[model samples]
Target: MDLDHTGVSADELRRLLRELSGDLLSRRRFVRTYVEMWPTRLSRLVAAIDDDDLDETKVVLLSIRSSSVMLGVTGLAHLATQGLHALERHDLIECRHVRDLLAESGDRACERLLELEATESMLGR
Candidate 1:
């Protein structure tokens, strides 16, 4: 939230988050769900890049960045922000931070998923 550069409304953002939380825990709960969604969304972002869909790619990246911030993955958020900036500027991008973060997140998520997947695989033996 680049308040210094971009004039984003603090009140409006608070209101938006407030409005979204319902039927259970709170807005904070939804942030967790958002965090879980990030890894999967990266796949679509990469696909859009491969397809040369710059506009959609940019939009997706920006949304992913925002999700990263809202979800409190600071490293992930930095990566996403770097990617978004590169796409926005239409310049050659070598976001090592973003690459590394994505790799770390994917590796971590895959490890967890595989562990769970194997739990069933080894069950009842």
Candidate 2:
């Protein structure tokens, strides 16, 4: 059999998200759930794009875009917006450009997420 993941299929991702989010609404909803995990998700997406896994990158990028807006993160939305265009239409080389745009931002996002998670723990939220 030729096993393949053409990209992070929304269905498979949705199943995983339900496990994490404790809800089962739709694939879009699953993606939106990552709004709270944007830092981790964006880092993974950028890495996936660098590895030339556009599909996986797309899923994470999609999550970031949707989640960013939903979570009131407009400044970070550009990263996902650029990633989406690259994933949907650009070739690997061009896609790398989009990934490059996000590289530093992803790093910052990770740091922010870490700090917030720690604060949340301290506050018992």
Best by lDDT: 2
Question: Clashing residue pairs in candidate 2, if any?
Answer: none
TM-score of 1: 0.55
Tens digit per residue, CA lDDT, model 2, 54-123: 6787787777667554433444566567667766676667667656655555545434434443343354
RMSD to truth, every model: 11.2, 12.1
RMSD (CA, angstroms), candidate 2 = 12.1
Q: What are the per-model numbers of colliding residue pairs?
A: 0, 0
Candidate 1 local lDDT, 66-112, one digit each (tens): 76555334445566677777766764345333544565564454344
Runs of candidate 2 with Cα error greater than 4 angstroms are 1-36, 107-125
How does residue 21 of candidate 1 score in lDDT?
50
Candidate 2 overall lDDT versus native = 0.54
Candidate 1, which segments miss by more than 4 Å at Cα?
A: 1-24, 92-101, 106-125
